[model samples]
Target chain A: MQTGFLKSSPKIILRFTDYNSPFLGPSPTVPTATTASPSSSLQQPQTWICFSCSYSNFASTPKCELCGVKRPDALTSSSSTSLSQTQISPTPILGEHSPTASLGEVTSSPTLQPVVTSEGISCPRCTFSNHPSMVWCELCGMELGTFKIDGMELSDDGNVEKTERAQHVKLAFRNGGSASFNNKLKSAMTDREWEKITEPISVNPQTDFDPVRGGISGIMKNVAQNQEEQKETLDQAFKDLDALMAKASDMVKLAQSIKMKLNKDSSESEVSADDDSTFSTYLLELGMSNPVTKKDSGSIYHQELARQLAEFLSALLHKHKGMMVLTDVYCLFNRARGVALISPDDLYKACSLFERLDLPMRLHQLASGLLVVQAADHNDDVIAKRVLEYIRQKGSLTAIELAAIENASIALVSEQLQMTVSKGLICIDETVEGVRFYENIIINYQWDQQALQ
Target chain B: MSAFDFPSIYNFPPFFTQQPNEATWQTQAQLWISIILSYCRFYKIHRLDLSDALTTELFYNKSINRRLKLETLQSIIKMMIKQGLAEWDPPNKKTSAFIYWKKPEEWATSISNWVSENGLNNSIVTLYEIAHGEASEGTEFHEIDQAVLLKALDVLVKKGEAQTLQATNAEEMGVKFFGTG
Candidate 1:
């Protein structure tokens, strides 16, 4: 676990090189960083207190120059809180430890002011400052600011106390100096599971060290294993598409079979014809992949548009009782065009051109000022008969109600009603509520009776 | 507006408004003319007030919640006058109309027949008796307008079937019908 933490440290001892570099120093910045580690990544001057001389000592001094005794504390004066309480000389001391006695001998102060590094970070455990750019502590090879190492290692081994070396290495790894291959792969899958898992692995040869180089051989083997599975699926899809393409001629054969069966019209064969009708309907929907547009037919735009509209509207007219509002046709036509939308004027021009076209559609203007495209087969008499039938069921009908019955606008219904009234098929009633239509009752009127005898 | 006396077409709301189309309006006008005649005949109402037709029960059709427009009412009345079934009583404002549900000739025949049935031929009878008298009470002419009654009498007098006699008062003018010979 500690070795994992050392993965991100900036520097490594010559002997610990194998344990540290996972990317084989492929990045040029990684090798130079270790050589320049002492001055740039670490190197903060500190002062320590001597136990025998009762004097402040430079942290670099191994022994007190005044009493020839070793400095007892491993940490600096500020770091060891109990160092002053342990013992004092009990007398005024002099020698290299006393500033007054050696003012000239020392020549210059060895203590450096604590630097306010605007860009670099100070190591939290050792308190030795480190460059913020460096991900690990250069002095102890500790992972700098490694939160995951603390969480993952502490969670794993709560009872086992970490050794100094293990703790230092653990700090480096958790700070994200160089993540393990398994950890990187695990995190990569967190986003898009399918794509990230299949994506080729990228390596930064500098900080990642030997693992990038060492892990390549292992990764290739895993990829080869996955390649076999993907190859089978592609081959299966290709086989299915090829099979469907081969059977295209078979669809026409089935249609021909139904045409033959339709002639027989037996009660048993009617079921087969119904099935064929559904299949034919599906085939019809597939027929209109290529639509005529201005780019396709140029100056013949209105003429071709009119022809195409006739085919589309004939079906729509059958659905809407042989007539539909012009505005509704505009919406349906533009929606079918997808991206290339035509204006209302364009649709109107196309519909008007239907006069010359073979299509049996006519633009009719109702007396109430509503425009509609109606099939030629549905004339005024047919509509009047329908209106009469509707009245027969409902007894009497208003313009709005009749509009709903005929799937037309109220204005169109009103105009149709006016025509029906003129034809003597119906009569208009103007009441306090609104206008309504009823059956014509007056049949004859010329007969006058002679006075009673 | 009594249901008993009202025609079925009176319940039809469209009958109140005059149609705009020539063919439709012609048929509708004829229908209105017939309804007005039958309605007047049933109620024995000889005079029709044009302004009152809009607000009064005759034209204020409650079932349809509509009223005949004054112009449409006048036009229909004019049609009746052209057909000789009605006449403008005062001829100036044309405000009031005298509806002849029966033409003068028709009334003359009806009254002449009444005189023969009652053995009153060649006998003197006051004009008031022929109109408001008890004998005429069972007929449509009972309480008929004086002008219409004089017109009916003039039709008989011109045919020489009745002769007018001098009366002491205008209301008591008398008529004598000749016996069949």
Candidate 2:
């Protein structure tokens, strides 16, 4: 089958070139004569029946000469059979006449001849029917065979020579992936396998009945079909996204219900110590169903954020021993909110509103200028007393040792020890081993007997 | 003396560190002053070299691996000068100072008592004899720093109880004590 198509392909090219010679400007006739005689030996009938309108066309005609429908087997069959005996006798005379006679036959069936040529390799970029021998489109200059022409324009003057101006069409792929598409197109062109894919579509009778075969109406039908397909795909994607959103909400609700059950169980008895309750509580912490957004709390954004932060941190502050670094709070709060993460400046501004809003959690700045979120009840005196007691017990304590003992940040411990020093409860010893704090024993020494004597 | 007994506070690591607080540091300065006076008195040390003192056990505690900084020692010496317990030896340079374990007036009272007890009132005594002569053996003034002896004699002269006679040589420089009337 492939060999027959290859053998007939040159004759098909000769016929098209001879038919197009008027616009292409008169080519040599010797090669045409040589190619046409052998094609005549293929013994095609003088006339053939059109499947669409059932009109009998001469073997030299590529389309239905009566109704302008393309012949289905034009690629493989070098020719088609005649319905009447009168048409059959003229086949031998036409074959002897060859190029001039076939050209005359093509001119006779001239209505849709230029628009839909059977053997012409169409420029996929501009839908211009190019002579099969050209590697690039004469009108568009795009590499031939990069795309298969989906439809053709049916006009009296579909001739490329009639248009004097050079028409340029720029294809811009706005959504990216153009490089990959070009690579695939290049590979398809290189393999020359697109012909096989387009051959079946051209022969399929179902596609022949499609209105997109030719004319302005065909283009409108093609566009409408494409839009319908796009709408279907978009609707499917939105439906999947909606289903996923619903599942997420369901999961949140399930977590809330489990948390509620755990709370109730713990209130009634002390049996809520299992891993399931702990896991649920963890999930509950992660789910901040309603975060205070700037959009939702306009004008008083910082105040509202402060309130929300206080509520979020009250429980967390207890777990962290009533103090957490401002940066840590920002991370935890943003993670819990899951979306609409706040900037550090916004978090800082919101924390600044804690005192104005009288929130249970306050913003505290250490001597080192590090900001922390501290509980309202967290007092310097308490920390100082704790440090003093620890220092008294340990004889002397470095900031690092106290930080480890209290499981608090070194900055906080250092600040606490400094406060104790100011209060004269403890004194600092700065040395090569770093600063250490000791009980202020110098304050209680007897001045008279110890040195004045 | 019997290996000058260091106070219990000397063993404290923080005691070697200069205190940062004002009131605490004043107390710490006093403690340092007292320790210095007794340490100097026990060792009969009259002059303190700032740098040399830092390496000694007085300023550096080896077991605690801590040492008083030079600035801290200098400040402490300045406090001692303010208290009249010390004076810069050359009267201007700060690197070394004369530690006055006993004020010059107290030293003068000890010298006058020694003269009255030995029947040497109205008698002329060479400054060198008061510091290193056999007659001054087993006395608090024996082997006294020459500069300190001069200061003590100056106090006596200021009191009109003694007069210093200038001599061609410092060893012959004498102070005549008047009987306490």
Comparing to the true complex, what docking class would candidate 2 get?
acceptable
TM-score per candidate, chains pooled: 0.49, 0.59
Interface RMSD of each: 3.2, 2.4
Chain A (alone) TM-scores for all candidate structures: 0.37, 0.45
Model 2 off-target regions past 4 Å? A1-255, A264-285, A447-453
Residue A314 in candidate 1 has what lDDT?
A: 80
Per-residue lDDT of B20 in model 2 = 68
Steric clashes per prediction: 20, 1
DockQ for every model, please. 0.18, 0.32
The TM-score that candidate 1 achieves is: 0.49
Kindly list the per-residue Cα lDDT of model 1 for residues B3-119, writing each as its tens digit.
325555677666777775566677777777877787677678889888976686678778668788888888889999999988987977789899999998898888988899899
What iRMS does model 2 reach?
A: 2.4
Among these predicted structures, which one has the highest lDDT?
2
lDDT of each: 0.63, 0.69
